[model samples]
Target: MSVKISLFISVIIIIVFSAGTFFLVSQQTSRLEDELLYRAKIQSVLGAETVATIIEEAIDNGVFSVNEAFDTDYQIFGNFDPPKYHTSYDSYLDRAILSIQDKFLKDDNLIYAVAADRNGYVPTHNTRYQQSITGDPEKDRVRNRTKGIFNDPVGIKAAENKEEGFQQIYHRDTGEVAWDVASPITVKGKHWGGFRVGVELSSISAAQTQLVKAMGLIMILILVVSLLFTFLYVTKAMAPLRKMTVVARNIAKGNELESEIPVTRKDEIGELQDALNRLRLSILIALKRKKGK
Candidate 1:
């Protein structure tokens, strides 16, 4: 019975500890993900503001006319089949935007930093994508200049709303999970376009997985240690009761009492041992009286 009770208690302890450990790990993971998303949003908005400032400065310096530049209509080819831009006119703003995007891409998590006109025309993209295509379908799809139209839901939302927003989206070019953030680009009080920054989620997910595994291993180790100590302590503590059981059984079977049970400490187990000794003494007295008669 004592063994059963000990085992039950150990099981409960294991359950409780496991639940608490899981909750703690879950909370930590949630916090980490939130922090990562927050940082991505900040970076995206900052990039947008920086690009907007550059365009505004160019306008002030008489480098470009906001009305002509923003309203320029570029032709789209392929009839929405991975639509490509067919334009002979290039703006000096393209070089500046590409340069800023290149700096933003230095961060490993940042997948792309791009800008598009209000009409969803991309004049320039990251240098890697701007490089001449090499006939690889995957490479050409992302690298070709014609592939840069900001017509996706997130981009269109940014352009239409003219405000900053964020969404979890898959990259159209690479199909990777990412946090897509967009901030409006206004030049000289005109809604020129939006700046978008895509931050990949794979790194954050990998870190979370590694953390959970580590925490799980630690929890398992703690459980093993706890169970070991509980088992040993329960066994040792029940030794007195086991011995008393044996003595009581012998006395009832008319067998000789070989030794006295000792009550070493003032605990419940000691009290039990004392009670069993009194019963043993009474039995011996009764047997002696019967024999004399």
Candidate 2:
């Protein structure tokens, strides 16, 4: 009886605790994602605005021609894996866009900071991704990616979004997921491409994995502790019943004064104890009357 009751209660403990643990994990995961995305949007807007201001200043000072910077017609330059392209306007942005990206790359979560034109032409990229190509298709695709058109579905949405900040997620060629938040870059009220800030969620993913493991460890402890507690409690609770079983067996064998049943509890077990005491008293009284007669 003790073993059966302990096992049953332990199962209930697992079910209840499992449900609560998973709910907490799901909520926490969602909160982490929301916070990460919020920060991404802020970074995108700030970076985009900063780069746009730099472009306008250079144009105003006559450092670079605005005509070349906004050129829609591009020329393909290299027969590389991504097909590198060139435009007359790309030279003006080559040097001006690097400083702002350097500042944004200080944060560990930030993967890349770059701006693309309306046609998804990237004149410049972060230096980290601008290493010299090694003539390997797979390697060059991830590294040394510059002067290329990023007109993929997600890239097109980012480059063409002229209204406000927007966010999207995609897998990088480096086998990691990134959250890309973009804000349109307008130069002197003219629409340029958009600036994108990429956020790598590896840290958040690591934290969530740790949380799940900790929860699993907690559940194991609960199971162990609960089973131990239930076993001890059921054993202690059923002790009196076991003793009464022996006493009732003795009484049935005509050992009239074998022992007295104590009514200690007010529950059904106590009622059984009281009934046994009454039966014992009735037997003793009948024996006394027979002796006198």
Candidate 3:
């Protein structure tokens, strides 16, 4: 019975400890993901703002002024014609995208990069855009559509006059993903275009998997240690009871009551030992009286 009780207590303790460890590990992983996402959003917004400022400065300095260049007099910044201007503009855009992508790459978890203008034109991609561009309905829609951020599939309410922000978007191929941030580079309060920074959802999941693996290892270690300690504790606790069991069996077999039981505790076990010794003395005294008669 005592062995059963000890086993029960040990099991409960193991379970409780394991549960707490799992919870703590899970919380830590979630917190890390949130922190990384927050940092990504801030970094994306900063990159967009920097790009926007550069463009605005270019406008001021006649690098590529708004009206004379695009010829699309729509009061909105549109395609810059002439190979030179596009080349220069694309060069600047590429540098910014590359910088952000390098930063993401430096972090081991992040895998891909995508930045689109408000027009959703693919500005920068680590992968060959044509390779992934399957001739599918979704791709067709993306190619045809002109505006709206599509990465964070869920609509994160675009900030009022947002120069930069962040959201999550989903790809039909991959569902429920996270984006670090997406920001619009605005000039003169008109929506020129935007840049988006994306961090793969796989990054978060990968981290979570690593954490779970680590926790499992720790739990195994704990269980092994606990098992050893429980065995030692139970053996020590039941030692006196084992001895008492042997003493009772010998008396039932009508053996001489000369053997002594050791009393090492003041608890119930000790009291039982004292009672057995007194009973042994009484039986010996009765035997002597019987011999005299």
For each candidate, the alpha-carbon lDDT, in order, equals 0.73, 0.82, 0.58
lDDT of 3: 0.58
Error of 1 at 124 (Å): 2.5
Looking at model 1, the pairs that clash are: none
Candidate ranking under lDDT, highest first, comes to 2, 1, 3
Per model, how many backbone clashes are there? 0, 1, 5
Question: How accurate locally is residue 42 in candidate 3, as Cα lDDT from 0 to 100?
Answer: 71
List runs of model 1 lying over 4 Å from the truth. Answer: 1-3, 68-71, 75-91, 136-138, 145-147, 171-173, 253-258
Better of 1 and 2 by lDDT: 2
Question: What tens digits encode model 2's per-residue C-alpha lDDT throughout 1-293?
Answer: 77788788888888988898889889888887788778878888887798789888988898767886688778888679888887776666777778778688887778888898887778888888888889998888888878888898878888998855688886776787888789999998888989988888786788789878887798779778877888899989988888778778877776845467779999978988998898888888887899999
For candidate 3, give the lDDT of residue 244. 84
Best by TM-score: 1
- Give the TM-score (vs. native) of candidate 3: 0.73
Q: For candidate 1, which ten residues in a row score worst on lDDT? A: 80-89
In Å, residue 164's CA in model 2 sits off its true spot by 3.3
Global CA lDDT computed for model 1? 0.73
Ranking by TM-score: 1, 2, 3
Question: Quick one: how many clashes does candidate 3 have?
Answer: 5
